[model samples]
Target chain A: MRDAVRVWVLPAGAGPDELARYRAVLDPAERARAARLAADGLRDRFTVAHGALRVPGGRATGASPAALTWRRGRYGKPALTGPWRGLHTSLSYSGDLVAVALSEGRPVGVDIQHVVPGGDPVSASARFFHPREARHVAAGCDQAVRARRFVRLWARKEAAVKAAGGRLWPNLGMPVDRADVVECADPAGRHRLADVVAPQGCAVAVALAGQEPYAVECRTDLGDFR
Target chain B: MLEHDVPTRDQVVERLTVLLTRMLRPDAPVTEQTQLMDELGLSSSLGLELLLALEDELEIQIDVEELDEDRMATLADLADYITANSTAR
Candidate 1:
């Protein structure tokens, strides 16, 4: 009950000047990561995400936005380092939204996904998700609801994996629909997951690493990108 | 589905490239070395769609039990595994 995760939702859409401002704060490594993306849209989102994600991390650690340093964990999860090493953070970008969750000591992972209209989630769930999860997804009344459930379950799994800094493939079959807080063995930890409020058509979930209850503080700061 | 001869590795690679291009609509050419998840932004669900599509396109069955980061990182890596593991469906 003592843990608290502060999450910030930022708009991923940026104009040329806005993109330049975000890129200006990025370190050389972040710039290189963004450059490797081929598509302009993908590259722009990456730039904005990495730059904007640092805001909450800096604020939590009392460091300047430009002073936060990030390095990839063994599994490619972005981790705070240097002066901000004590603060834990994770980020996810979906469509036009980027969500970042930060906590003082508990490693946090946040996922925001834009559910595609008319995409088939049943087959995807059957093929990839846990048996119980697949059944839960299929239980949805219609395709629309099924897709929403599919992405929600997916966000939970991904957020959990990100919290443990574990790989996603092996944990795909982890049954998350059973309860909000599930015991997972692959990560060897308890994942407390909650669905955060998001824009319509977007599914958002945040995972905190522990069995104890925690509070999620959500902040919307679209103005940061502008 | 009709049974057919197992496609050679090169044939698999060629068709896989076409499939990747059509599916991804990528900015650059989808090469054998292209990173599927990173460059293409392939989600786990989309990744399944791809494997299913590949099975239908090639008329083969891929033993997905072996599918992991080691084999799914790039087009070439996937093609190699598919060539070895697939059977006429």
Candidate 2:
């Protein structure tokens, strides 16, 4: 049987009083990382993202949000350390959204980007994206359309690389197929990538192994947890 | 590839040193033995950005996989790789 992938989205910003409640769930190391950030907004985002990670992560592992610990890989990919076996996870945040992806039996990564206008999508694509992706983004009829396309492609690659535990630098030149569903090669194996339909103004994606028709269960109403 | 000559080791080193200093660490010592990640705290995105700059400056295309941990360990290693891969000046 194929494993299912779950994506949870939480609001990125929080008031100071609420931020403290979320901050309570993080370990000392996470708290330290949050504290080290120079900007209060960035600090709040880090606290909430890390804290939100615990909710789905704990649910999948049957551990409390505060009880979960993380061990980073050689490439610095964070993984659950203790008894939460068999669950793979990834997280990403952009602008107003923090997304967490969880899967069983396969590694997973999620990426979401808020598409801002006036940024040179074609030029940005040429610099950072694979030649094929650059061409694809440029093929869009207009600037706004192209920018949106570029973000989708960018999110796909980011999510795939995160899932593969691969470096983004090398994979920047790695070509992904034009189809919505594509596969990216990693040292370990190939990972399946998919474009996620996200809320307006954002592009989201999830990457994992296997070809099964996995369902994406998304929840935006995570206010109670915070 | 014929349009531009492969830069010499010293040339590559000099250019890389300047690039790293400007983009990654300013007013810091950059040597062949300097670790990109451990010493400079460069993230994967930044590492890729560096690679892209090198490609642009050198007029060469380097596969991202080629810049694995071993190849990107230090400044000299990348210089050697770039010199070997680039068209001979």
Candidate 3:
């Protein structure tokens, strides 16, 4: 499973020691970006996310965690460029968790959404999601369940578009709540999407472009991430 | 739902904030100067949903064909585009 999609997630609410340890791996630019965020919570989340990114990027590219630099791609997503371009990567965040995914050569995309406590999922799904996905959201037993279903479907849709390097507005209507393999009617490309195990109150999805089968390996432990 | 009335920029931002708060339930206050895509982390799909809701509530038609995400840096920027491009359907 060497080429399996590698995913790592870390809880954003970490102690000072752990947070600083992760912060050390970030470059000056990333640290500056983090500092520019006004809220401490947001700053911490950004730190953890970039740190987690560097750890896997290091392992994937065989470079020091601090040595890797991500350049903005066509869609403005931070992607590995130059020497590290060979390793495809994507990152996402929710309320209190962040995730990073890496693939050897295939275009990969990952998204995470939190099922936060109060929102108009019924109206939201109806307004935003495809008719098929809206129906799926409506099928949930209650508001919380509906919100969970809604966000999971959204994660899949976002992951698909992210992998395609396509704008999401044009593809939000694509019904992807039914299958692991996202079969959009468009014949332009195909993506394999799966719901990865996420922390409580979060929904995570990973998408990779290709027809060949691949494993989705998730690393749950972050104790020795460095 | 004023179908024929042209909404002012302030009106548009007011309606946008109402819809956004209802959908996202964001903890932070959403001001007109707020970065819709950056600070709020509004996904493009959700942003479209917000736009559609604005169209419905404001009773205006938006030509999204030429919309550029790069120029839509803040709520005010989006409102400017709507005010300039929108017409009664």
State the C-alpha lDDT per candidate: 0.80, 0.73, 0.78
Question: TM-score for all predictions?
Answer: 0.87, 0.74, 0.84
Give per-residue CA lDDT, model 2, range B12-88, as digits (tens).
88888888888754335888877664455444435555666777777766544455566667788878877776653
Q: What is residue B41's positional error in candidate 3, in angstroms?
A: 5.1
Off by over 4 Å in 2: B1-89
Name the regions of candidate 1 deviating beyond 4 angstroms. Answer: A222-226, B1-8, B55-73, B80-89
lDDT of 2 by residue, A1-226 (tens): 5457888777889887878878888999889777655445556777888888887677667788899887877666787776775788898887678888888878888998877665677866797677888888999999889978877877888888788877665676566646544555554456777777689988888988655567777777554665
lDDT of 1 by residue, A51-142 (tens): 87766555566777777877887667778887677788888898777888888878888888888875678977886788988998999998
Top of the candidates by lDDT: 1
Ranking by DockQ: 1, 3, 2
Tens digits of per-residue lDDT for model 3, A130-190 = 8888988998998889989978888898888778776565466778877777754333588
Task: Name every residue pair that clashes in candidate 3.
Answer: none
The top-ranked prediction according to TM-score is 1
